[model samples]
Target: MTNKKQRLASVDALRGFDMFWIIGGEALFAPLLALTGWSLFAFGHEQMQHSQWHGFRFYDLIFPLFIFLSGVTLGIANKSLQGLPLENRWPVYRKAIKRLLILIGLGIVYNHGWGSGIPADLSEIRYASVLARIGFAWFFAAMIVWHFGPRAQYAIAAAILLGYWLLQVGFGPLTPADSVNSWLDQCCLPGITYLNRPYDPEGLLSTLPSIVNALVGVFAGRWLRQKAGQHTNILVGLAAGGLACLLVGLLWHRVYPINKELWTGSFVLITSACSLLLLALFYLLVDRWQWRYFNYFFAVIGCNAILVYLGTSLVNWQYSSNSLFGGIAAALPDAAGTLVIACGVLLLQWLVLRWLYRREIFISP
Candidate 1:
């Protein structure tokens, strides 16, 4: 099915909700703990924090969800590339590679300050990053879409996940010092890693499985397209699929272990399942029921998702925001000051995006 050239506001809304947590919602919840003094709100704060090593949390879902959304876009846009010949598709592949390189550059810069002209110390650069992970997942997923039809995409996803699982298991008896994933990083990307750790969470080896996560998203998107206008069917299918993934993932955790750092097959399934369910929800509320007003702010951020993400780094709005609003917030009690700062910064970010949205100045890579 050809997606309308017009944007899907539901997609935008779901993306914006995901971005909200990273941009400010994560910060917002902590202060609520101080203000509300251990109510249901406290639970939100806890979920915002990542799990120590293994298991999952709401925060852990965010990264995989981003990859999943990429797949959704792929499925939604499949019509555009559906009939093109392999030779005709070279330009599109070039653009994708270009975007991937740019994302990698941005990830590196995000880790090392631009003012210092990138640290001479090689260790300062973190090549394995969220942006880099997204790039890898998106690149392969797009290639899959480019070469194969919907059926092949599913087969490819299964292969990727199963292959990665075998790799981890076949490598045998991994200790923390000898983690296969960690070893791949040390061997491949010599100078850079995250937090000076031996193994990066977004490490090279684990990235193979991450692509499967994106493929799952692609599958979900294709399903949505096939079932368009059948609201009840879509929601029921998403729920059933999500529950199956969650149950299988939990069962597989017995042998494989659902480690986000590893990007285990189980993690991919479970997280992708959650993302599918979440997408169904936003679709039902905003697109199906037409309850769009409530998530209007979310759509604003969603329009220029990457713009706001990079803007936060490129422009130090946080420092300026703190100078403007921190004093008042500081007068408040524990963690409230930080929350106020976060709110102020988020508002500033939103207004800037809102202005850009008004002018239709979306920054697309």
Candidate 2:
């Protein structure tokens, strides 16, 4: 059966919320811990930082959550194309491929490739990047959604997580130098700049399990797209699903351990649970109950998430922020000055996104 494109403000708002942290929210808010010296801010600032080697953190959730949200969007978008002839779906498939390629290219650019000057050796480039991982995971997950039924998609996600777990267990210990994930990266992506020497967090093998993150999002997206008037039931189901995943993930952690760097199976389930619960909360507030006053700021950014992400990389926002607010910042104390500048940087980025959102220019990939 065909379905119309259901515009879920919560989805966009959530996307923007996730992007907010990446772009400037972390910078803007992290200073609060220093300024106010509040325990809450201290706790939040701690969560903002990534876990060094193993363990999960709120910051670690950012990347996988974005991928899952992309899956949710895919599920929402494909609604219109659901019953179309196979031939008719080619255009979307092409678009997905194009997006994947563009993101990969952009990922390289984000890594500061050849921009300064092409390295004498290609090995100098960081082949695996946060954006590249997102692109790859989203692309494969999209292909699965395009070609398979929900049952098959679920099975595929299960097989991927389980298979990856087996590979990690059977091949080597979960150490940076000795883990199978690192070994695969060393063998296959030779010369790639490893984020952690000899083992990039966005390495090839770990990406296999990452696809399940997006698939979980697809499941949520499909569930959300169901017929209207069942919002409460949907909320309960989402909460229950999230809690169940959390439980399973904790149990698995005993064996595999929740390692964000390795993107362990337990890590996937834990993050998926967090993503689902977050989605449920947002849907409940913004879509179901219509508490949208606070969401507009984020929704504006959400409307143009990809644009802002690339813009932050390409545009010298910091220079602009300092230029506009430097005098004010200069007048304040050190901590306060830093906060002002951060706020300015965030404001500047948001204005750019707001302008695009107002002009109805939403750039997605």
Q: Which one is best on TM-score?
A: 2
Those runs of model 1 whose alpha carbons end farther than 4 Å from true positions after fitting are 1-7, 79-86, 113-124, 334-338
Off by over 4 Å in 2: 1-7, 78-89
What would the per-residue lDDT of candidate 1 be over residues 71-133, giving only the tens digit for each residue? 888877774566788787778878999999988877776665233344365654567778888
Candidate-wise lDDT, in order:
0.79, 0.84
- Candidate 2: residue pairs that collide: none
Residue-by-residue lDDT tens digits, candidate 2, 94-205: 8888988989888877777653365546767777888888999999998898778899999999999899899899998899889997788888874465554778888888
